[model samples]
Target: MRDHGIGHIVGTILDAPENASVVKELKEHAREAGFKAGYNECLSHVNPFYKSKFTDERSGFHGVDTKALYAAAVDTYNNLSISAIDDIEEFLEAENYVDRLRLLYDYPEEEETASGSKEDAGTSGTKED
Candidate 1:
């Protein structure tokens, strides 16, 4: 899990300005370490913006359910990062294959769904109409 989180930090650093040499070096290091480095060019162009009030509201819920909430939040972030990494790897592999085929194509990606069971539905293990 720490490695996954570090991957996200490394990815962000790689996208930062004045880090081209560091990014190149990291790519080589990742290759040696048997880690696949993914490029996220869009992250470099877009700045993430969030409502401060909304963030505070969410933070206020911190100790509401303490352990359960912390577990859920960590699980969610780890899952999201893993999914993003998987999507990037798939895109890169597809791009390489398409380039070899000399065919023009575009990859459309979408968010992955959570692995929830019917029992996970709120209230009694039954669907509500």
Candidate 2:
């Protein structure tokens, strides 16, 4: 189970300080759905691919296994609260789901920043030369 970006993606979601509550929610949902993908050597990529905190041993994994992990991640993201993500339709429509996850990971911060800028600008928000 080599690091085929799944470890990075999952780690990004689960390891973020801002996502502590979100991780709890995800774990609950995963439990309800019988998803053990986050743990167990049979499921988690990190368990098999990562040998240490700073090392990644590439043993390589099957396409089917990779697809299953990706699907689990995609489904988890899709099930996130609306408050966590304003709109997930665009992400669902993307052909490249892996890249979509990367985008989704950054979407919330981008959205918050954009909305904050709008509020700061107020009405007649045109930029002056």
Best by lDDT: 2
lDDT of 2 at 72: 71
Best by TM-score: 1
lDDT of 2 by residue, 1-129 (tens): 122334654566556554665566556554533433333344354546666542223233322254455557557666665422333345545565434655655423223364455222232312234
Worst 10-residue stretch by lDDT in candidate 2? 118-127
| Alpha carbon lDDT of each predicted model | 0.37, 0.45
Error of 2 at 60 (Å): 53
Error of 1 at 123 (Å): 56
Per-residue CA lDDT of candidate 1, range 32-126, in tens? 33321111233233435533312222333322444444455445434443433444456446535323222222222222347543321232312
State the lDDT at 103 in candidate 2. Answer: 62
Full-model lDDT, candidate 1: 0.37
Model 2 residue pairs with clashes? none
